[model samples]
Target: MLSVLTLNVQAAALPRARRLLAWLDARDDNLIILTETSNGPGTAYLLEQCRAAGLDVTHTPSPDGDRGCAIVSRLPTTARPDLLAGVTLPGRAVAVTVNTESAITVLGLYVPSSDRAPAKVAKKRAFLTSVIDGLRGLTEGQRAHLIVGGDYNVISRNHRPRYPGFLSFEYEFLDALEQLDLADAHQRLHPTTQAHSWIGRGGNGYRFDYLHTGAALTPHLASCDYLHQPRDRQLSDHAAVAATLRLTVDHRTAVSAPLAEAAALS
Candidate 1:
């Protein structure tokens, strides 16, 4: 089976990155998507460790002071940078085609978080719009093999406790994903269940992280659930989401870049 997990590293520093790497190394996931990454020592160390462990790593460092995403896979993968070339924050989204039993294109995303400030609002809106446009550009077959997941930074309209201050555009992004045939993997399995990946100082919970599977792939989604160990252990402020697919991976070919080269890029 294909086991996939997504977590926001919170741009961890060197110390926390080492601990996070240890935790990740203990998991048996085939694919892992890490969001809120940076071109810092912490991210570099994490990527290097993954490479040393013989896992393929794909990452495009975010510009200085920016955050991005990375993909770590036990199976061979080809980077698909063209997929999100037009995104406002290109580094925040990375796509790779995994050479599994049935080739799947996994896109890792780190949507910008925003407050009431006009500039931040515009930034978030633009990125969300570009993501929608990018997905729309995919052909029917491509969409069918896609799995997009990460920190969305926006709660769904039906989210319980209904925190206020979210603008229309934020909600529209989620709507657009569904319109594009990407079903919320977690919600599909637990329609009436309530879960949160992040919590605020006031103790309010928000479901800001998600995993959306394309229409064709949704049927193979065996299970999707949130794990709070990362958060509970203070590894990160956000919980990790894990999903298991009935699909299998081809173990014949496992590719990974050299540690030196991977470290240089990170």
Candidate 2:
């Protein structure tokens, strides 16, 4: 069993930040991600906090907005070309390969919000399209286990938005995920125990965080949850989403055969 957690930590108060870090410390979640990270000082501060706690931080920012995204992973991670190339998206973006007890690859992501201005919105679309294309190169996690996670911002049938009017964006997003054939990680589990990552200040709430997986990975999903119980007033207006999955493959099977084969031939 391997666990991954995603949150938009709001980057507000030191106390609130500490609370999040403390929560992570308590859990055995192999990977942690935060979206809408404060660009400079606050990001550095949070990075330090994670570092002191023994998490290695990898950060990235968008060209159009003050907000950014970060990956805090305990498991060994290597940069993926899709994320390392640094495509021209508006907000912060990050992608990493998490080597866990069960799986070798987990995509650590933070996509741009569609709520930003017109140009930023356009940039967000570009980012989404790029991600879709990048996902195509990935091997389906049937005999293998792979995961794509982050603040997806748009939810599909597996999830929905807090505000009803926000469905327009979600509709498009659902279509995209459907087109990609990515299954909602939470749906395979008991829906009653399911939770999402958002709590509306207006009292509206929705499940916006996600773990998109392929058909083979769909069944391995054992549990999904949204940690909505707030420690403070508003922690970046988004809660954390966590999951546990029972993978079918052993760690040895997860090794990249292509790379190994190439080395053998050489």
Q: Candidate 2, which ten residues in sequence have the lowest lDDT sum?
A: 255-264
- Model 2 per-residue lDDT tens digits across residues 97-210: 665544455565566666556786776677666666566655555214556677777765544443554535545765766556666677556555546567566765666677
How accurate locally is residue 155 in candidate 1, as Cα lDDT from 0 to 100?
86
Clashes of each: 0, 1
lDDT of 1 by residue, 86-183 (tens): 99998899999998877899999999999789999999999999999999999989998999999999888999879789999999999999999999
TM-score of 2: 0.76
Cα RMSD of all models vs. native, in order, equals: 3.2, 8.6
The TM-score of candidate 1 is: 0.94
Give the winner by lDDT: 1
lDDT score at residue 54, model 2, on the 0-100 scale: 49
